[model samples]
Target: MSSSSAPTSGTLTYDQAGVNYDLIDPLKVSAQRAAAATASHLASHGFTEVAASRGESAYVVDVGPFYIASIVECLGSKALVADEMATLTGRSWYDGIAQDTIAMAVNDLITVGATPLVVQAYWAAGGSDWFGDAQRAQSLVAGWKKACEVCNVAWGGGETPALAGIVEGGRIDLAASCTGLINPKERLSVGDRLQAGDAIVLLDSSGIHANGLSLARKLVERLPEGWLTEIDPVNHPGLTYGAALLAPTVLYSPVTEALWQAGIVPHYCANITGHGWRKLLRHPATLTYRIHTVPPVTPVLAFIQQHAQQDDREAYSTLNMGAGFALFMAPEDAQRTVEIAQGLGIGARIAGQVEAGPKQLLIEPLGIRFGDDDLQLR
Candidate 1:
């Protein structure tokens, strides 16, 4: 299904809301450069760094028989939304918040075909009093354990610091780092196998998966009822806007593991996070991604676009829309991938293909095309 475009007037783009990638990307480039210089230091520990993996989702290290992949990610501003929604709904949402934090890190780790082994939590609060609520604190602990089980990773100990001045007193900042293993050596995927004619299989996301919450929160301010607003008054009654926004992110580590167990090695994979659909072309290669179809967007996302006055390009560039993760593999393996995900009770579909052309993405259904300039993660 396609999203209806709102008129240009009063358009609420992501940058206007607070996040300006133009300013953020340059720092990424700087970090990548600085990080590259430190790669040589690894040899002292008898480990060789995978130079090509530097700018990828997960960093890889050659440790003799297998590679170790690691990624650190945060839940962004979604936690703040959960805090507000909890006050409005009179229910603790920290379980989903904990899950969202782990998913953010684990999802990125799995893109390289790594099986997550351990996840370390980083929960920082403005004050120690933030954890004084028994219900909220216990929900967070239980949720973290549950999400770790879902990802098949150990909940390694983490630090919960009380930074009174740095963080807002009422809110806590959530983040995590995941370390995974890529065994059998052949399981590693960093787009080296990507080629023309590869089919693009998309995995469905459960609502907004912790990427565009900043803009989502901004959109909520314009609503008359704010967090208490019903997402779809006629169809999905009682589903408040806050409840929809707080939906836990889908953990994709199992899906990647299932694909490997089925002998389907995706040429490349991407966790559709901050960059939105532009992430489809994230592999640093000169190829054109032609998407013939898109997944059905969730009602909350549709509501955000319609209410925020975001056009097709703006909405597609900012939010997941519906497709959370992408897998590019041989055309023959595409259906098998979809079936494997479906077997796991997750939505999947063959959405597009890669063609030999310039580095760009063409969403045929929406006539939206994003050039290489749109994404600058490297």
Candidate 2:
């Protein structure tokens, strides 16, 4: 029998299929409201044209000729996986997840055309054993140092809490907040200069860069026996799947810096995460993104597609689909941008172009169109 007809042994509800909006909806609403309140407060305080007006990453405060942007993000469900890593690899769980925490926070700051200046982490752990405490502290500091060095940012102090009964099995929660500065003259906003035929450049991702694991985990859990034990079955090195998944999020500072040096300023930029183009369309404008090509879909993504029988739209909507950072540059600047990224040893490709539309995303070849409601932050 073909895979689709093999069997319907167990039913899969949307929730069981790994979409739990009950928990996700409240948080999403709260975040949207908080962002709106912040935007209003900033405007009331005499700031003009907050980038929050355009929804890329965070609220950008217009300070004279410059803009200061701040972004905060937690490690998300991957924290649970990092904790499991301690048991699986006999390594410190905190060390496993710390760099990832910092990466998540800083990447968003850069998405809004800011250079990260400092990063701070907030850690939570259930009654820490002596070994756990020492290891976590050591790992967090080490991770912070590494991240700071790579991104050329300062490592601000962090918070660590030992909650007695709230957390289970000595679980540790990791989160980071980042601050960056962008010259207002240099800040980029979605649709600000984005026009038809402008090139869409894609920066290759480092395997599942910190989003959509809620669904990936569910897919893994549903896999039949012997699947997990096989090496290279998922196209990624089987032995390092966990470590690769936990790989520190790539810092795009180098890419952004290179673009700045090359004098190829993008009109719009976004760090492709949780919601993909849905997040990109936060700005209220009538435009369509036509993605003509994509980077090679890594094995892990392909495996998920094959196993879950996920359609193209669902897969791209939930996962990064191999593009980590997207750049919307002038049609004339696309080649130079790709050259600059390649010079930095980063793989880059032209994924799509922008066009006049009713503010929708039309993914060609795949024949998927995301309407206004589909892009809304629910």
Candidate 3:
């Protein structure tokens, strides 16, 4: 029998699986170092790179009086989920995948306190025939445009490449990039204001928000019926496993813009996608994140945890579980931040606080502690 407990002899881990970060981490470091070396070239273009923005969610460039934030993010294999759903339910989940792609890009760009201005898409397919289906093509177009509208950004043109040999003939990879403007210059939240007494408010995610789908898809393989398996009726009734997983990601750009407009500036912000909750401490600081209360894990995530049989350490470190975006601000603004997010129709709460100490993430409720060693981005 499988159990979500300690790792025994047959336990599964992310490292043991195909997506090993150990191998990928070094490549990222090498690329970042190479990218940093070219910063001096931007100086001649009348743009200077922000000193500490090299490893941030978005790259910030100083343009005279204002700053610009830019990011490029892929939807990962989440689009594969959409493709599978199309075969099983005969309905394209590309619309949801479109929204996920936008969320993945804009959410990261906003972490630097920039308002997205222009967004572009990258749809790489194995063959041109992939877009031959009218329903899938139209759904992707409409969904991507709708998400851009929610972000209040212009839908700039994008590229659709047909690389028959590189990608599977039936599959397409979705990704996006956007540029944001940080007006007035004082609105930048790049960790300079992040201090010990600040509150950590976490915005909730709408179930598996486009991070660990590569792992989640593997979990489905171990299931009795794979994608066709029904989600727990009591928890997520009337949804197949693929449908529950394909639900559109929650858009957080509007929520952050609302908070900014309210005159509540966060000291730092992080889009909790790739690194899960540990992303709250992405900045290179010696402060500790004391999580007093952990948010309720979403039903879809709960299903993943139970079926995958992972312990808390593995699960929380690998999946967002519930928390999506994080904001570090003064204690006085914590409640109002939650209020602003909730007002924007997004769920949120004050989940933790920053403390003066060695860098670590202490989840008091779950008895889980992640040291700086556990979250090495550099």
**Model 1 worst lDDT run, 10 consecutive residues:** 1-10
Higher-TM-score candidate among 1 and 2? 1
**Which consecutive 10 residues in model 2 have the weakest lDDT in total?**
1-10
Cα lDDT tens digits, model 3, 31-124, are 9899999999988998899977888889999989899889999988899888888998887888889999999999999898899999999999
| Model 1 vs. true fold: TM | 0.96
Best-to-worst order by lDDT is 1, 3, 2
Model 1: per-residue Cα lDDT over 47-123, one tens digit each: 99878787789999999999999988988999888889888878899999999999999999988879999999999
* Model 3 whole-model lDDT (C-alpha atoms): 0.87
Clashing pairs in 2: 286-359, 287-359
lDDT of 1: 0.90
Rate residue 53 of model 2 by lDDT. Answer: 35
Candidate 1 lDDT score at position 298: 94
Residue 345 in candidate 2, Cα distance off native in Å: 2.8
Cα shift from native, residue 209, model 2 (Å): 1.4
When sorted by TM-score, best at the front, the candidate numbers are 1, 3, 2
What TM-score against the true fold does each predicted structure earn? Answer: 0.96, 0.86, 0.96
